[model samples]
Target chain A: MSTDIAGQAKKMGYKNIKVYLEGEPAWSKAGYPLYASNDFISKGNIVLIDLRSVEKSEAGRIARSVTIPSATLKDKADSIPKKAPVVIYSDSEDEAVSAMKVLKEKGLKKVALVPGNIAGWVKSGGETTSGPVVTTIVWKRQMEKGEVSITDFLKVAEGSATDTVILDVRNQDETTAGMFKNAISIPLDQVGNRKGELPKDKKIYVHCTTGARAGMAAKDLINAGYNAFFLNEDISCKDNTCSVTE
Target chain B: MQKTLIKFIPFLIMASFLTTGCAQTGTTVPQLIPQHGTSGGSRIQDRPYPIFVGNVSNVSNKAKVIAIDVGKGADAKTHLVKFDDKTKGIEYAVVGHASIINYEMRGGEPWATVIKAKLAQLPSGVTEIKTTELKSLLDQGTKFTLVDARPAKRSIEGSLPGAVNIPSDDFKAQANKLPESKDELVVAFCGGPT
Candidate 1:
């Protein structure tokens, strides 16, 4: 998370940055005012979101949580308040991390992962409703950690191989600013509806400005039976030279 | 443009009662005028942000070169800043002038580089004047336009006697505050020697 924050900062031309260790989850666990669910429901300057399914959110949620679902968050970047604290939660930690990537790419500030999901909030003495919990089944193939870290992805990207394709899932404005040589840009919202355009034969590597959208998009492509995995990395491109963010 | 000058006329009138106060020159040299602000200075004039306040000590179009003197009385350093199309015809920085900058290792190093780049591109004809020299001119009641280069808060906190305060970090948009009379002397100074 520190590397991700530092990477984002460096890309924005910010200097002299210091990263808080383990960030909000650690801070909240230390009992240091983690924006209790009840407190979050009433705040005007905050955009609290449950990054779960509409069906799951309908079952139970902290009041005022707008449901955009984890998969479709990439397309709704502008809907999220850039200046406010964007608190996102899901069934698990990995789900929240995925939503965080999209928020980071949008350059939103004060984004935090809720210490635990709604379940964690209840465990930490916060309030929650009892719809039990409807967990989404991982019927689709998912990318396990270390299968494609940023480092390994970069090696393949820099290598001279026509078989491996880099799929950029960022929006048109982002891709217009810059894009890798021969990278296919099928934005996240369009991927579910436009799954046919994704290549099946190639070793498909997905990415966004940050990896959240790519992570979501990768799951979609893989579920639709395409060879794909999202890179947990930052990518910047200038002309023909596409480089990884440090 | 004429309307803007018309607006400034009233400010200039109200500022007549104000006196010239001392300011930092960002140099080690002893102040040249100590007896100037007997009443401890007056309200600074109304100026836009990022433009400074001070009196012109020197203006040399014939020389067409920037002259800076920074450091202590004896070990004071002098350098010539080149003026071109980008610098808006300024002669010199005239403050905390350094030949080689050794920026602090913290995040300020990038800003030092940015500052170096920006200093090279200051608006044209915008020469900086030292605090002491401007104070000396003010003591003699020299008919010159004064501008407070620092922000409004800095001026309110206690500023040089008769300068106008401009908001900090917003200079280029307010360059019109300079007097129309080329013969009239103008100087802008702020945050000296720090």
Candidate 2:
């Protein structure tokens, strides 16, 4: 059998395994499509269809996969464009192969299976989308002149800038001890919806107890084309000292 | 057929009422369970701040529970879920790519108790803890080591003093660099606990 031929041929039983070795590197080197798992088969120019349930899809799903849960695929198959490339995937390749056979039997052409299914795709570094694609304008942080430290953010809080927006990305509990006076508190989860409340024209500064969350929120705002900066140091109401406890 | 339709209509109405009414009342806050140790050996305790169960998409299967620990109130409430296969309503599982938050106990009311109490006081789906609790914990010498779960480059420029760098991507290959003593307090955070 070709499967065990390589081992047998090592002892000069047969040379059929040589062909597989030759083809393996060539395929990868030439940038031919590689399946992360043998569960799904893939062909060029095929639409990748994810056959995962909705709950699983919510956490995330294969990138660009047109999701149609396997249980509902029969009824929804018609919703897909018939002439386009069709590649199906599920938890395993069996379902994809079955889907391909059924589609072919139904006189549909241009159908294939994703290699190794969704699991394989994940193993191969494919990305998936999480939950509803809530739109949030992303903004990047630009350190201002002489504003490299948390102390700078503190200065801005103490009436240093005109019409500046201080956005506290920390959760309510964090602000309970004491947030800067007149600062707007918006939990990161709600930032996507509350972006409208922020002044796009004003210089915005984001802060958390530590700088990580503030930095992330700042990046998101930056990607959204807003002028935002993350406070680089920890500033707390516990004491006048801007340094945070490690 | 008419009788069946009539019989089913009330049930459908009741079902609709249950669904919509529940939605109006708002999502139930899943019980938060804090873990005392690192992500690998973290055992769920009856504590709060470090662990929170939000986005209760399903509650039918307790084994299928997908609860997440976003981080302390000082950080953003980012989505992070740890899966238990028997949990209800979890038809799929996603291992969060973000590194798990390694929380070191900062005393106070013990994170588990505080979380349960706070969840009751706060609005559903909202867990806002007062800073006093955190400060109290901090005062107890329940010191925390904020491990930067990013690369060396990011950790060097801006890192919590004495904070160790343990990039999640390199965790497996470089797990040896970590302390063998599991009892040592360490808090690992990456991208809001991802």
User: iRMS for all predictions?
Assistant: 25.5, 25.9
TM-score list, all predictions: 0.26, 0.27
- State which docking tier applies to candidate 2: incorrect
lDDT digits (tens) for residues A1-246 of candidate 1: 122222333333433333222222333333222222334444434566788887778787765566768887888777654545677788887778667767877886456656667787656666454354433211122335424766657766666566778787777776787887667887654565566776678878887765655665665466457788878656776655777753
Evaluated on chain B only, what are the TM-scores of all the candidate structures, in order?
0.34, 0.28
Q: Pick the candidate with the highest lDDT.
A: 1
lDDT of 1: 0.48
Please write out the lDDT profile of model 2 over residues B117-176, one tens digit for every residue.
111111222222222432344347665443445455334332332345555445556444
For model 2, residues A120-183, the per-residue Cα lDDT tens digits are: 6678666667775222212233443323355556667766677577888777666676777757
Q: What is the C-alpha RMSD of each candidate to the true structure, in Å?
A: 24.2, 26.8
True contacts kept of 2: 0.00
lDDT score, candidate 1, position A27: 31
Question: How would you class the docking of model 1?
Answer: incorrect
Worst 10 residues of 1 chain B by lDDT: B109-118
* Backbone steric clashes in candidate 2, count: 36
